[model samples]
Target: MTETDVVVIGGGATGVGVARDLAMRGVDVVLCERGGLGAGTTGRSHGLLHSGARYATADPEGAAECIRESRVLRDIAGEAVERTGGLFVQLPDDDPAAFDARIEACRDVGVPTETLSADAARETEPELASDVRRAFRVPDGVIYPSRLVAATAESARQHGADVRPNAPVTDIVVTEGTVTAVETDAERIEADHVVNAGGAWAGRIAELAGVEVPMAPTMGVMVAVDVGGVDSVVNRCRPPDDGDIVVPHVDRVVLGTTSTPVEDPEEFSTDEAAVEAMLSEGAAMVPAVADADVVDVYWGVRPLYAGDDGGRGRDASRGFQVHDHDVARLTTVTGGKLTTYRLMAEAVSDAVCERLGVTEPCRTADAELPAGDAEKLDALVEEFDAAGPADTDIVG
Candidate 1:
C-alpha cells in the first residue's frame, strides 16, 4: 500500500505545480495522472504566456494575478518562457474608444502598456492590419507547456514527491466523511489529504467524494497555420472575442479561438466550421494567415466553473476557486488560466498546509526549478532539426 500525506489527482500544469509547491514545503505528496503529462488541456493551449492585458478590462483581479505570475514565471522559469512580447492592435474598423479603456485598465492593474501608431506597429509587426489605428504593447510571451510540466514534475520528484503518470484514480476512499485512501488501478494509496486538480474532470472527482462542484466544460478551438509572419503575440484591441488573437509559436502561427459550452470535456471533436471561423477571425489581425496552409486543428476544454450565479463565454470570471471539503479532507482547485497556474497552486497549497497544520509559507514565487535535462533537450532539438523546417521548433 502506498502512503503519503497528500494525493494529487491530475498531471496538468496546476496538478504538477501543486505537487511541486507542497513537496518543496516538505510535504509528502504523490501525484497521479491517468495519461501522459501535458496530455490534456495544458498541451492543447496556444502557448501564449499572457500579460494579463487580455483580461485587464473584463477581469482586473485575474489580470493582476496573471501579470504578477507572469513576472514570477519569467524570473523563476526563465528557461521555459520565450520573451515574445505581445501587441494589441486596433484596426480602423474597431472601436477606438475601447482601446483607451483597455490601456487604462491595464495601467490600473499595473500592467505596463506602450501606445504605438499604425505605422509604428506595422513596422514592428508587418503582418498587422494595414488599417490599424493604434497599438499597445504588453509584456507577453510564449510558454513551453510540456517542458514546464516536466520540469515541475521533476522538481517535485526531487523534493521527495512521487509523480505517477498513467495511474488513473479509480475511486476516493471516504470513511466517516474524511478521505483515507485513493484507489487507483494499480494500488490503494492512503493519504491524509487529496487535491483534485483534475482541470476539466474536477467535477467528476468531486462527485466521487460526494461533493458538488459546478463546472461547465467549455471548448475552444485553435488552428495552426504553417506560416510565420508576425513575430509577437497579437490581439484585438476590443473586448474578448473569438479568433481575435494570433500567437506565433516555433514554425507555425497559432490562430484561435471560439468558446462554446460542451457537455463532455473529453468527447468534443473539431469541425470545419470552427476551424473556418478561427481563420476568418484571425485574418482580420494578420491578413497573411488566410492564405497560409493549416498545419493542424485542435481544441482545448476549459474547466469553467458555473456557480449559482456566474456568466459564461467571455463574460465568465477568470479567477480561480479552491473548494476545501474539510470534512472529507479533499480540495478542488479549478478555473483560472495557464498564465496564473502558479498563483492557483500557491493558493491551494496554502489551504492544504493550513489543513495539515503546516506553517511553511510559499516560496515557489522566488524558487527556481532545477535545470532541465540538457542531453534530452539536445536530442529533441536534433530530432526536430532533422525533421526539416516544417516541424515546430521545440526549444526549451
Candidate 2:
C-alpha cells in the first residue's frame, strides 16, 4: 500500500540517476529493480568515461553530449572518475589523411585535443606500438561503476527516495487510460507517474502498459587482462569497430568490444572468436595488451533505439530518446550509454515535471554526489577495490 509521486523501473545507471534527480527536486520517488543494482547492461560496461573523441568524426551531436556530460561527471562524481585522460592512436594501416577530419570534428564539438607525434605518443605510453602513425590526446577518464551507482542510490535514499532492489515489477495497473499503480513481487505501489528506465528490459515494461517501443538490445564482449598495460584509455583512430578500445583500470586492463544484434537481451553468450578479436585488436593500440594474462571475459547489452536512420550494429546512433505516453501517464527513457546517464535522466525528469505541473529546474548538473571530501573519496575508493571481480556482475 505504498504511495509515491513516481516509480522508476530498472536499477541501472539511468534509473539510479533518475531517482537521485527527482528526489533532489522534492519529488516522492521509488525505484524498483528486478535484480540487484546495476545487474543489467550498466554493470557490463568497459568503464570508460568517454571524452567524445571517438564519435566526433561520425556523430558530432553524440560527441558534444559526451564532452559536456564528461565534465559534469568529473565535478559531481569525482570519487568514481579517475582523470587518466585518453588517446586516439592511428595505425600505419589507418588513413593518415582522415586524422585531419577527426581533429577538426573534435574541435568543432568543443572536445579539446592535442596532436602528438608517434615518438611523443610512445613517450607518453611506452607500451604503444612503434608503428603508430598519429596520436591525439583528449580528456577521457575511467569510471568505477559499483561505487558510482552505490553512492548515487545512497544519495537518493538520503533525500527520501525508496530504492527497492529484487522487487521485480510484474504489472502496471492502468485505470481509465492512466497508470494508477505498479505491482511488484512484494507489494503494490500506487504512483502518480512511472518512468521506464529499465535499459534492455524497457520495451517489455512498455508492453505491460499496452504500448510499443523499439528497443534494439545490442551485445558487446569485453575481456579483462590482469596487467595494467597503459595509464590512459587507448582507442583506435578509425571508425567504430570491434576491439578498438582499451581501458586501464586499477591492477587490470580491459579490452573491448564487439557489437552484434540480439533478439533477447538476456540471451547472449561470449565465444572464443569474440574474445580473440578483442585481445588481438586491442593489442594493435597497446602492444602489451596481447601478452597480458586474461582474468575475465564478459559481455554487456546496450539499449539502442531503432530509429529510421536504418543503421544497424555499430552504425546505430548512440543518442537517447524520451517517449511520453500521455494517456498512460508513463514515460520511457532508453538508449545512450553510461557516460551520459545523468543527461538522460534529466531529460526524462523534465518530461515528468511538465506532466505533473512542477516547475523545479533540474539541479543534477550543479549538484555533486555526496562524496567531495578527501576522506570520503578515499573511503569510496577502498570500497570499490574491495568489491573485486565478484561484484563486477552487479555493475551492468
Tens-digit per-residue lDDT, 134-208, candidate 2: 799999998877667767777788889998877899999999899999999888999999999989888899999
Q: Model 2 scores what on Cα lDDT?
A: 0.84
Query: RMSD to native for every prediction?
Result: 3.2, 2.8
Q: Which stretches of candidate 1 lie over 4 Å from their true place?
A: 371-396
lDDT of 1: 0.83
- lDDT for position 337 in model 2: 78
How large an RMSD does model 2 have?
A: 2.8
Q: What's the C-alpha lDDT at position 392 in model 2?
A: 52
Model 2 residue 189 distance off true place after TM-score fit, in angstroms: 0.4
Give the Å error, residue 119, model 1: 0.6
How would you encode candidate 1's per-residue C-alpha lDDT over 1-396 as one tens digit per residue? 999999999988899899999999999999998887666778778778899999998889889988999998888774567789999999877898899999999999999999998889999999887788889999998877766776677778888999888889999998998989999999999999999999989999888888888888788988889777668999998888888888887677888788888778988766789899889888888888889998878788888888668667656666789997745689999898888888899999999999899998898888886534544543433321211121135643
Clashing pairs in 1: none
